[model samples]
Target: MKILLLSFILLGLYGFCLGAGGGGVSSSTSSGGGSMKETEDTKRLREGRPLILTCEQNATNLETKWTKDGNELVAGDHIQLFPNTTLYISTAQKEDKGEYSCKTGSMTEPKIFHVVELTLQKHLPKSTTVLENDKLSLSCQVQGDPELTVQWLKDGEPVEDTDNSTRLEMSDNEYDVPNAVLSIKPIQKSDSGNYVCLISLYSINVNTTTVVRVKDIYAALWPFLGIVAEVVILCLIIFIYEKRRIKANFDDSDSDPAQDVKNNVDGKKENDIRQRKH
Candidate 1:
């Protein structure tokens, strides 16, 4: 019975130790988190601004590593690892755009960052009406850090001007950064449509539209100005006819009046002669 009791005690102790060991292993396994896929997160940041990307963990102690796309990141003066888990970009630039992630044990979903330096908009001469045969000049302005690849479009198609092209001329002027000018020399009615100034930088595309309404030089005359001209010509003809008629009346009427005056004068003279002879 003593031997049996001792054997029973040993068996119980072994079972208890085994249970404790299994519990310890389970705890350790849970402490290391499994990799999880996340939805895409995208960010648009202004160039030259600071940004932070973080990787939070459920574990108390974690060793974190950073990667961009799939390459292990090498921290530089412009980029640094903060708190050993968070990424700090000193100044976001166009070259900084990439998919970035941090790995505690497994990579978190990548955060996409895109940096834009400029925003372009129509600057001068609001939607305008220009007379036909007049030169059309348009300006497009940009704000923020402007790095631009510019193209001018008429209606909906790209505008390409050659040396021999008579109607369109394009030039870029850089007062501070630069603005584009489209010169439509002697703009025609066909030139009337939406003129868009397209500016693109990196992955950002911006455009400004200016509607041009080309007016015929005689557009205002529509129906009224022509009518006025016809009335003037008719009035001039009537005035000339009336003046000629008055002149004819003067010549005919003056002959009768003159003859009557002369006859009266002759009769008076005859009377005087007769009196003297008597």
Candidate 2:
């Protein structure tokens, strides 16, 4: 009886080992299948155009279901999901501007993708309006997660082979450094117009316009006019004073001449009479 019991116990232990081995194999197969699918997806994405992706949850299946700009994408949309689960946009256009989400299955939470909007702005250092003959500087600033290439435009034309009357200097704030200065020495009137900054990033282009008006030299002529007015007022005061003095002298002369002659003759006659009597 003891031998029979021992045999049964040994058989039960062997069956347990076999069951454990089977479970390990099943798990390995499942993991391998998932990894292969991811690799294939990455390869397909590389061969396709770039696409913007959005997800509702983190654990969603990035392989099977993908959405662009919050809209469900068709199979032929030419978008591929990578192992790292990043969505690529082959050619981004104005219509492509929106949100994206990625998901695995209906039960998984959706992961929302952050959409970065690229903007190109034409910025002047500090003062937008500068006096003529003063040093002026303008910078083309591009804001986006990915780096953008900037191009300067003047009067709706590309600025190339331009003269030094409106000199342009280019700098960057790529590493989050503030104050990207574009120095222009001696800004000119011709440089005044709508200045534009064009930025291109990964099939996306944006432009910003700034109206630059260089103050003319004649703007300060008012002060000179003020000085001239002061001088004119002083001349008028001097003329009025001289005219009054002349009138007073004439009035005194008209009365005094006749009286003086009469008084002199009477005094002389009196003196002669007195001398004779003595």
Candidate 3:
């Protein structure tokens, strides 16, 4: 009877331990699963900013390791690991982008904690100019995810395609990068203002603004007129200088004609003296 009683006690303890162990595993898995969804919706990271990621498991004394594309991450100057399973990057760069996974002790598969992707937007001129009745094109290039949306705005209002004269064109290229161009054929002076390119993807929205100035057709003529005036003024100055130089030469010659005669008589007298001495 005592042996049967001891067997029953052993079975009961085994069952209790199994239940506790299963419960703890379930709780940790639940916490990690919740964070996986949150990480999916994370906003795009900007360059030159700190990037931090934390493991969300709720278990005590858990061993967590971070990896990128299956390579184990080592703590260094730019990368740091905290005791709480958190990773810190001092400054985010393009090369530091990839799939980052967090794994716990003896896990068959790592949970993707975050995917680091950088949005690279090309720069536009701060101020652009267009002549009246001339064609102008402004291109906005964005590279990253394919689902990016681009929109153009003018002075806080949406730009419209009017009669096909002013329209936007998207490029279909081999590399599949998103590119948008705003074109105005035969642009008018009324088209001058602040133009903005707004790019959006998921939870991230970024924009760049450019000021456009339109000049009149006659506005180009002013520079030509100024050049002609300069040439005319230079010719007048040369003419005045040449006329004064000739007048001064004529005056000097006429003022000393009598001195010229006296000089000729002195030269003959010296020549006769020299011949007599010889």
Candidate 4:
């Protein structure tokens, strides 16, 4: 009976210890689950733009520390830190993308840690000029997260690549950014407008605009017309100068005739004096 009672007590203690161990694991998992959710946050920003990461904890006057890629971040020419839990990047570069963390806490409370995966989206602005009845091509390339959807818009309406005059070429492979080319064969004057390359991923959307200017066929003739006008003016000036020179020669010839007649009368008087002497 004593041995049986001892066995029951031992079994009871073992179950109690197991229960205590299970409860501790459950409590640990609950706390870690919340931290995992917080750490899984991510943010995407456009390159060459400002990025501001702020902590929204209810605790005020908490000391905050910011770090990027396991290194502490400090204020610099392009980076700024606020008294509040805010990290400001004046201009985001490719090197600025990485894991960022913000820790905020007071002396009495536990520190709250937040982890964000920072990513930068890239786009290049373009400007194109095509002459009338000439081929036009504009390339719109972007880099970002996968599942990128691209749309080309002229003015405000969506561009139709199926049109006989327009063609759009896209990359066959899947990419985080779209590699698209918009082409218009024999582009017309009416096609001159803003062409926008819009990219969307989930709820985020970004666009880059290309200003397309169509030149008229007669645009090249403008310099030719200016040259023709200049030639006409030069010919007019030469013609007027030649006419004035001819008129001056005619006036000098008319004065020469009077001088010739005066010389002829003087010769006759000299001949008469010679004959009287003989």
Instruction: Name the 10 consecutive residues with the lowest summed lDDT in model 4.
Output: 27-36
Best by lDDT: 3
Per-residue lDDT of candidate 3, residues 54-93 (tens digit): 6654445566798976799989998998766677897987
What is the per-residue lDDT of model 2 for residues 1-278, given as tens digits with 9 covering 90 to 100? Answer: 34654554465555545433322111111110001121111121222245444333254334645576567865445454554455656765545544455666553676544344454332333225656777666555546544446676766676654564246666666544233444565777777765666655554555555566676655555444544554556556667877888999988777777789999999999999999999
Clashes of 3: 0
TM-score of candidate 3 on Cα atoms, chains taken together: 0.48
What TM-score does candidate 4 get on C-alpha atoms? 0.47
Q: Which parts of model 4 have CA positions greater than 4 angstroms off?
A: 1-42, 45-128, 161-179, 254-261, 264-278
Candidates arranged by TM-score, highest first: 3, 4, 1, 2
For candidate 1, list the clashing residue pairs, or say none.
none
- The models' CA-based lDDT, in order, is 0.61, 0.52, 0.63, 0.59
Q: Least lDDT summed over 10 consecutive residues: which range in candidate 1?
A: 24-33
Off by over 4 Å in 3: 1-40, 45-118, 161-179, 218-221, 244-278
The global Cα lDDT (0 to 1) of model 3 is 0.63
Ranking by lDDT: 3, 1, 4, 2
Predicted candidate 4 versus true structure: per-residue lDDT over 108-182, tens digit per residue = 442333222222233434456666777666555544543456777877777774343344444422233444566
Error of model 1, residue 258, in angstroms = 22
Q: Candidate 1 on 1-278: residue-level lDDT in tens?
A: 34654555565555545433322111111111112222224344557888766676333455667777678887789888765466788788777766676667655554343333454433444465677777777766654343457677877787664332477877764434344777878777788777777766545565666677776666544444444554566567668888999999988877777889899999999999999999
Model 4: clashing residue pairs?
none
> CA lDDT of 233 in candidate 2?
62
Q: Model 3: how far is 222 from its true place, Å?
A: 2.4
